[model samples]
Target: MTSDTEEQEDELLALHSIFGSDEFVRDESKSAGELRVCVELPAAFMVALTEGETLSQYEISFLPPLLLTFELPEDYPSSSPPSFTLTCSWLTHTQLSALSAQLTDLYQATGGAVVLFSWAQFLKEDALRFLDIDTLLELPSGEHSTQNCSQDSLDVALSEAKNNKHTPATGPTDIQSLDLSALSLEAEQTLQTSEIKADYQDDQSKQISKEDFLNEGSVLLPSSSSGPLDESEQGAASLPRESPPNEDQRLSGRSLTPSQALLSQILIYDAAQQQKQFATTVFDCGVCFMGLLGMDCVQLLCGHIFCRTCLSQFCKLQITEGNVQGVTCPDADCDAAPTPAQVRSLVGEELFSRYDRLLLQKTLDCMPDVVYCPRHSCGSAVIWDKSSTAAMCTVCAFAFCVTCKKTYHGTEACQKKKKKIMTENDAEQPTAAVPRSQEGMKALWDDYVSGSKQRKRLLESIYGRRSLQNGLVECLSEEWVATNSENCPYCYSSIQKDGGCNVMRCYWCKRLFCWSCFAKLPSQGYLDHFDNGTCNHFGSDFFPAT
Candidate 1:
């Protein structure tokens, strides 16, 4: 079974034991009074939280539909082990109060002692609603084999598929045959090529090369620093390691580039900085500065140093009463609020663990149960009873008569249902099928988005090319508009050229000018003549045409 399913079973077993007897309701065979619980969580809740996901430094809240379960004792008045569930989508103040009351009632009625122990404490936030309910279709117990085979199959498939985009191996080495611990570091590699050789001289040269290379060079992974890098310290990160020694000079007698040499130095520096956030801060001789045999000394902002015991008392007494400002350094006449590091150390491992739990609780304070709608048109509230012979919809009252979602309402009938309805609607819908409207909408949306992106890219390229062309033309031309008046300036007549060239003579005055351009010439004494042009008509050399 999956871990989630196994966890579910464990929770139910815990609830059964908590009720005081294995044979519930005085029946050895029947297990109704055993008080089993099941919770249906969303697929997103599949991930088990990592240690990094938690923040323990402050007051927090949690949101959830996590399923929790407990079994109630049969004999209530004499010896009661009270347990109940409060089902809601969200946690209001009233719901929280009611839950607290239920816990209180369970304790008060049962001689102020917990007869029931909490072996299973947490479930995913959304699964809490069906905590005390039954189920249909229990998951198989073959998850161990399935889980093991899944990784191998995925690795093989990923290795073989040419179309896959994701880098399945995450590194150059093939993961299927790799054993990380057995791999040894290579020492004899030199990156210097002919191109790089031109840039760097041997140690024997006087003046070093000054030109910067445009190449991306080698991958410069972040290395350990003499002091912790500010970004690395924020989130948990390991220190960097040194580069392996170059074997090019030692083994093959190959040359190395200056870039490679610099990279090695950087790696070495980072490796040296690995174990430390900063350099060791040594203090001079003083009675107060002395490290005690039992506990370490923590220095406050006021420069007062004290043992852990002093800080804990200050938080409990001063901070608890909301008078933390009044809390100060225990040393004579100095006052300072306690530092977080000091407070954490003072609290110690046990209290820190508790605080961490509280922090998780606060972060996940009141999330409600959420499940996807099983129907095509509607995503409605549908309870999943895994153990049942068939799934019945509460909202539509449509009953599925088969485990495979086929309705056997006529000839085939399960032990659970008394009345069977045979209809097309009551039959189970295929998992792959989507509602017509949803399918249509999805296609339309996809097409629209894809078309929009292609158009945008096309326009951007066109605009970019035009902009470059415009820049060159702007430099070459003086005034872009009306620089050339393509008409006769003397008579204000339209000009046209019909010949192979631009030169033209006016028909009226036989004026020497370009028929295509009636504007003044940039240089002096450039006469225009054209055999074919509108300006070349019957004309005298000195006469002006009316």
Candidate 2:
């Protein structure tokens, strides 16, 4: 749409502007080109930089200046906005920050020209702001824009941008060597910047880095210096704080290796051997976000992860409550089959002890595929130990004296004692009814197999309905939260954000108050001073908003 002459003219004009502009200086490099600019910041604002700790949100980059041609209006007003593009230099968190604020300032300045800001050193003598030095030759592990090599990446990038100023490699140096002339000059410049910040701040108390001001662990709580600020107590005078979770989860390959395979073999081991690390690896249950105490956590049929306590609790509680159809992944989201094999391996024989053989047979036969044991050591695992009058532990093979209900614990009379105990067991076991019980189990199996889909669909339907219910959503509300505060309006009381929104009960007075203003007495709840402007107490009829 445009003519070639217009483009060429624009390009040449931009070049002229760069060469003639006093505010920016251009550096030439074999690999790249760069433009440089620097600005001094007030200390208070610098401190606020730290408070903006959402790593993803803002970047304080220490990057090289950009290099691009900008076409200027012949009648450029000193107050008119300036335009430029960012390029060159790797992104150091600090540099991008300087550039952003500076660019914004320049564009907003009266007749966008060089705002001659001066530092004591730079104004008296034109000085370079950076040095070609590499500190700490560690790998760049955080999310980087480029997958560049680690050795002197930033400084080297700068050097390359300035046209490949190669300083021959001197093997990695000690900290002492870091203060040498080339590096020290930059360090000195850095020191000057720090001093400038401190000088401007004068008030250390008011100048804490924004990041420091925010205690990552201090949930919406009052500052420590302020006093007995419990995270719970909320008031009108205090501001509510909302922050994001720490992204500490790292990226690591989890392929099953030879070592892991070897470990798997030893998992079912109960034989007499030297004590080894019982729990060497921990896998969070794929289903539930519970802390699996041991390394043996696994996903059964549904691949939901759970700790022994959580998984066992869910399975027992649900099944007992007559939700056998729903005795699956305790995780509200998962509906996978609970693999019985995985459960047995973790618990060994503990799961079997939950019921006598009769109840177990019925349950297992009914939910053959939907069995799970909440043992960290045997997550999504199963153990195989067949028992007659006497049977060897499939894992340990230590010949348990089942008659005596012991293993390797039998003496010469152990076999005799086992024989006598099992003799009673044999009688107690339904020998005559074995055929009938087995037939009944067969019939039960047939019936279930015939209606498997229907049963499963019905169970899933009920579960989905319950979870999506309004009450469940209300129970998981996340908005009604406040931090701890030192000063309470109602006497000497401290508090933390327990739950709910916009309303809080003073533990001491049992009276509620406006979560925002503790100064105002609560006119609501159990002691509703409705006459005094508070609301009524908590009631089942009360349904929280979605």
Error of 2 at 234 (Å): 23
Cα lDDT, all candidates: 0.33, 0.32
RMSD of 1: 40.8
Cα error, candidate 2, residue 526 (Å): 51
What TM-score, over all chains together, does every model reach? 0.16, 0.20
Error of 1 at 57 (Å): 31
Best by TM-score: 2
lDDT of 2 by residue, 196-233 (tens): 00001111111112233222111121111211112234
RMSD of 2: 25.3
- Stretches of candidate 1 exceeding 4 Å from the true structure: 1-290, 293-295, 320-322, 348-546
Candidate 1, residues 1-546: lDDT per residue as tens digits? 544334334534665555434111111221112221223333332211112344212111122121222333433223343333222212222333334344434445445233323312222322244233122211112110000001112333345444443333322111111100100112221111011001111222111111111011112332223211233433322123222212131212444332233223333232233212112444321234544532244556566555555557655554333333445576656655554445556666654444443333323322222222334333333454555545566676656543333442544554563565646444332333221353333332222223233322322233332222343234323232235334666565555444443445666656655544454332345533334334543333323333
How displaced is residue 243 in candidate 1, in Å?
A: 7.6
Minimal lDDT window, size 10, model 2: 191-200
